[model samples]
Each structure stands twice: as structure tokens, then as C-alpha cells.
Target: MSDLNITHEFGYKNNPNSQAFIESFHSSVQREFVEYISFNDIDDVYNYYMSYIYFYNHLRPHGSLKYLTPDFVFYLFNDNFNDFISSYDFSDFFVSVKK
Candidate 1:
């Protein structure tokens, strides 16, 4: 689907193009984390997963986000996508990152 079309379909009122992106984020984290972590139960997994999120948001530099971490990229992408529109298409915003 076209970016604008898909954006409308999955978007919320404030950010009409946010749902798909959020879903894609969950999926990527799930694939990279959910399947990889061998936690005995939910608590252990939650603890480790929370740490991983900290790394992703505060440390990991994402190429798609202009080599910025999720913390940086979050504001960048949401503020205005015109800067990185070429590298990140709408679909990519919904696809799992390569493991």
C-alpha cells in the first residue's frame, strides 16, 4: 500500500501514521528478543527485556535513524520524516529489522 494510504489506515488522531510503526517496532523487538531470550519465566524475561530496551533506546545507533539511537530517532522521525523519507518508507516502519 502507498505510504499515505497505509498511514491513514493505521494511524491515530494525533499521529495519523503511528500505529503501523508501533506494531512494526513490537514485532522487531519480539523477533530479536522474544525468540532469542531463554528466560525461565515472565519475570526474568521482563527484566532482561527492559535492559535490552534501554540499550536500544539509549545506546544503539540506528542507521535508518541517521545513526542515532532510538531515543534520538524517536523525536527525529516523529518530529518530521521529510529528513529521512528516502531511507525509511512506510512499509519499513512496519517491518521487522533484520536479525
Candidate 2:
């Protein structure tokens, strides 16, 4: 890790709350996706996660984000907020899920 200039940081000792968000995300991924599939190789795992991440950020609406996709909220705040608001179309921002 040192040779690669990578530094690993751990949560505060015995402070589970410090890692709550990541732990929750891990649990969600395992329960919602990983449990249902078998990976053929490392590349397959990587490809699966890449698509899943795109769906998670761009298509899936998060309750914690007021039912908005993360990509929507991210651009809403990072871009010119006022311009984004003025040109916003709610119909395009949401995706319909099929049962």
C-alpha cells in the first residue's frame, strides 16, 4: 500500500457509527443483488457492479434523498443550482418501475 501511495483509513476504534453508511450500503448490495447471482470471474463481478452502480445512482430513487435519484440531486447542487431549477423537468427526472 505504501509503495502504491495508498493510505488506508479505519474507523475510530469501537465506533460502529463511523462506518454505518458504508456498512448499510454493503448490506443493501448483498441482499438486493449479490445474493441472487453467481459471478463467473473477477471481470464479471466488476461488470455487474458497474451496471448496478449506474442503476443505483441514476435510476433508483432513494428514500433518504426524498425519493430522488442520486445523480439528480448531485447535479442539482453541483451545477448552477438556479439554472438547474429554472430548466428542471420533473417528469424526466423520475423513472417508472415495472412490477
Candidate 3:
């Protein structure tokens, strides 16, 4: 369903957690696109969002992910964190200490 249709069907609720997440997402959007770019129409806005989503998930490097794209980390780890721990060099984070 379209976002407009959803808005028409549902009334706003006083959900603080939902509101906080939405506010954070909007702040990121404002900083990333709305501040520097202008959309020509609904199509333009949709296309821009699609491109941004691809870039954000597949191309952009995140600090929290240690400068890796979400897709890269997702596929590499693939829910098998044990393999990641065994294969990847974590020497920087894990040091052998002499007691």
C-alpha cells in the first residue's frame, strides 16, 4: 500500500518510541537530501529515495560497522558470527594478557 493510503486509513497515535525513531530518520533525511536537493515531483522523490536506499544499504560505509556497508557485513556474517570471529582478524580488539 502507498504511504498516502496508509495515512488515510490510520490516525496518529501518541507513541513516543515510534515518534522518536521517525524523528531521527527525518533528521537524517533532512541532513542527507532535503537540505541540499529539491524534488521535482512525487516520481522524482520516489526515485531519489530508491537510489538513496540502495546507496545507504549497499554502498555507504557505516562507522558502527567499522566502515563496512550493511550488505557486505550482512552477507559476510550471514548470521554465522562464529565464522566471522574465526576468520577475521580481531587481534586489535582481543589481546592475550599475562596475568
| Highest lDDT model number | 2
In order of appearance, the predictions have TM-scores of 0.50, 0.67, 0.54
Which parts of model 1 have CA positions greater than 4 angstroms off? 1-18, 73-99
- TM-score quality measure for candidate 1: 0.50
Off by over 4 Å in 2: 1-10, 81-99
Write down the RMSD of candidate 3 (Cα, Å). 10.3
Scanning candidate 1 in windows of ten residues, the lowest lDDT window is: 87-96
Q: Give the TM-score of candidate 3.
A: 0.54
Estimate every model's Cα lDDT from 0 to 1.
Answer: 0.68, 0.81, 0.68
**Residue pairs in steric clash, candidate 1?**
none
Better of 1 and 3 by TM-score: 3
- For candidate 2, lDDT tens digit of each residue in 1-99? 999999987898888788887877888799877997799999999999998888787777888899988877887778577776787666756677799
Worst 10 residues of 3 by lDDT: 88-97
Off by over 4 Å in 3: 1-25, 79-99
- Write the number of the candidate with greater lDDT, choosing between 1 and 2: 2
